[model samples]
Target: MPKLPAELRGRGGPDALMAAVGRFSDLMTPLLGLTARGRRPAGPVDRSLQVVVTSVRAEADGVVSVRLADLAGRPLPGWQPGCHLDVHLPSGRVRQYSLCGDPRDRTAYRIAVRLIEDGGGGSREVHALAEGRRLTVSPPRNAFPLAVTARHVFVAGGIGITPILPMVQAAARRGADWHLLYLGRTAAALPFLDELAPHGDRVTVRTDDLGGPPSAALLPDVTGATVHACGPAPLIGLVRDAVRGRALSFHSERFTPAPVVGGRPFEVRLARQNVTVHVPAGRTALDAIRDAVPDVAYSCRQGFCGTCRVRVLGGEPDHRDNALTDDERRSEMMICVSRATGLDLTLDL
Candidate 1:
């Protein structure tokens, strides 16, 4: 419940906070280091802390945002726009959510969860939590980060807007040129329309019930601009194809697993465990590895989280994960999605 050092709160500017956090990163991880693609390795050190749920309220249809605070009225660790927290649910299901509240407000952290009826039960458990509930959570870890640019363009689909909201506000606070193209199934399904309305023409809301779907028209000329998008896989795919030949740089985050097209059943040879696990063609390598090991660490099995990363002593990996860098992929592989290009893969375990 103790407050982070005054230097961490930026009362003395960011340098002090960065240095302090970096020095104590093992206790509470630092948030600055990111790949060129705005990604961080998944297995951040064990730094979970306890916090109380101060409030819980509905944001939109099937979406609820919760506010968390330290029990002793102290400032929490500083986090930027695209960072997410690992929420350890009472049922022992760990889920990740983006921080949507003001980055300047270190006193409390806010995040929104969209209930997925068919999900792995994480959202359902979060929705059922009451006020004053205590929860274990990791310090903020950012896989998607906003680039410092003169002009920024944001595109968010459905519940994916949770991370982009803070980025928009950060841009506005810094007087950077920014615009948004927010899409949803219906107006009622959008969470922050009322808040975004005040931004005027800077924000555009498109719903399937009214405007059909967002087209290239909603996107401005991305020439020399940095684009940030988060949403369903299909929307991100469309954006990728639409901007294929443009000079713009695009960054995106998706909650869904990457399509493992044409992946064949492969064998994972656990060198340390001395066992051979067959990863079925349709199933993920993580599933097969977990079946054999039963205790391997993994989170966000969608390939974004690097928790399942292991050294590939042999075999050519298909490498479907979005988290690893080209250099990192040479030696390590995220077992959650990446599969063997050849018949068998030998893992260091």
Candidate 2:
């Protein structure tokens, strides 16, 4: 942000200043107008932006739906389950929320947010805001994505339900076999149960005290199915243990910084540049590459968006990315969460 002279900040200053500003605006209008008229500039922004709030709905206790309009009244980049958007809230802070409602709605994105007790005023302000408050938001980005597998078992704990909701819906829509295990503290505490019950035998709902531990017995049947679990750390850890031998991918999003994963310093050779990045203890391969070499590009460093997918032209990848499938792991790798299993990793940078 640039600072303005206190005197020149607001007042419709001198007539000269007004004329100059108007002239600048008028001059740029034609350039934009030309592009708008379908005359593309050599370098033009390919993406279109539209600010619109088409509708609002109360889905659960604190969850609400705010419909956004895509450009030219068409759908924007459709997202899979576990996708989120960075919303510039009415409170002027950017908060990310997972898509919670139906995934088939091509016209708009349905996101649900729970009001937090001490969560930095963002969700609270959103709770109080009524329909029709326009806001700027980024395109959807996925942090947890569904893999292409023969079968799947989706597990969600409490509010962690947002991301998996869409995946199960997608599976159900496809008539593909899937089971959803949703656990919350209480029936009332679980917002979407009413909408979830119809899932019949395919859906399991459990609410119990921590001391009474939810059963992990259902996991052995988890064979031949991709196990997708999202929830609090403890629950996720438990699920991970239960699904030990299965081909599974675990993706977790921490609301806050978490202790680093334990790993040793490994060597990674970027074939193109002949650069070797050293993965330090507790550091990921992506971290090593960026810290040791700065020019590499990456985004959605969590490994779900495919933005950081790179080739392991040589050595085996100690795959940790949340999005890679058994097939994908054999090919591209996500440097963000993966580690080098061998002495040296040759990357196709």
Candidate 3:
């Protein structure tokens, strides 16, 4: 992989943060000509790379901290905060994980994976992975990005903190005024608290009584800063409603899929394969595909992962994958949650 340019570093006594900003800004200079978020490359493009596990730290019952080093005797892509990597597991399952380390180094990348009891083995396999394990990963891809507003307010719930970790670190490095309200079931379940304690005056930890709901009082008065969040659906709903149209800004990332609105049954016709399957209400296209064709496979059943992507030949598809843009939505498809607007949908399958 090509190392990041050296000019990004500030001259003389300037800091790495400014250097990174300058480096990234130059990469995005082409984007400045446009106002809308274009689909074009924002910076030097990142690619999928393989990594070797150097260490693993089990945080709690299911949470595991991971450190990845490049296996090709080179550094991983230098990714901005909030960038994620696709991990190819030994079980032949691929999952996306957020990079939680500083982006300045072309060196190793770090991430924390939480094992989900109900999930399909990816997290459990990752947690059990020992040192020397080889993991194939995508170069950093950032679906969630920071804004240049005056300040920032960060909200993280449980394992959702993985993606937000670097953002907080970046905020501190920029001397940007920011605060983090970390809401989890307990401190034992949270990681990196020791490192975050110094941000004490700025960082707040919230734990609710089992079976009770968590309050968002820690989200202090906000007028200028942008609020960024990532967590479970319930926490997001609560925080989203609380900050509805308030002076506080809001943004979030979800590992879990968004709730899909139930609708009437629809017909899915595999265009090339000539297989027509009726996707009934309460059933997704993937489910229908699996029942009729078990050869097809996917990692995240949720819309969050793009492993189940297919081509949309005709009809409007309700795109639910985090992998696509509005333009891509009109073209390709995520068979996992997407449905057909027309009675007959044509999919590449």
Candidate number that wins on lDDT, 2 or 3? 3
lDDT of 3: 0.78
Please state the error at residue 336 of candidate 1 in Å: 1.6
Q: Residue-wise lDDT of candidate 2 within 203-277, one digit each (tens)?
A: 887787542556687453777788888777778778888888764554555333233576767899888888787
Q: Give the Å shift of residue 73 in candidate 2.
A: 4.0
Please write out the lDDT profile of model 3 over residues 63-179, one tens digit for every residue: 888889999879666788778887888887788888887788677888898878777668888888999998788767777887656688888988888888889988898899898
lDDT of 1 at 4: 46
For residues 100-181, could you state the per-residue lDDT of candidate 1 as single tens digits?
9998998899999889897667899889989999998889999999997998889999888999999998888899988888
lDDT by candidate, in order shown: 0.85, 0.70, 0.78
Sort by lDDT, best first.
1, 3, 2
Write down the TM-score for model 3: 0.76
**TM-score of each prediction:** 0.75, 0.59, 0.76
lDDT of 3 at 221: 63
Indicate the worst ten consecutive residues by lDDT in candidate 3: 1-10
Which regions of candidate 3 deviate over 4 angstroms?
A: 1-46, 210-212, 269-278, 287-305, 312-316, 320-331, 346-349
Backbone clashes in model 1, listed as residue pairs: none
Which stretches of model 2 miss by more than 4 angstroms? 1-49, 70-72, 209-211, 218-220, 248-257, 260-349
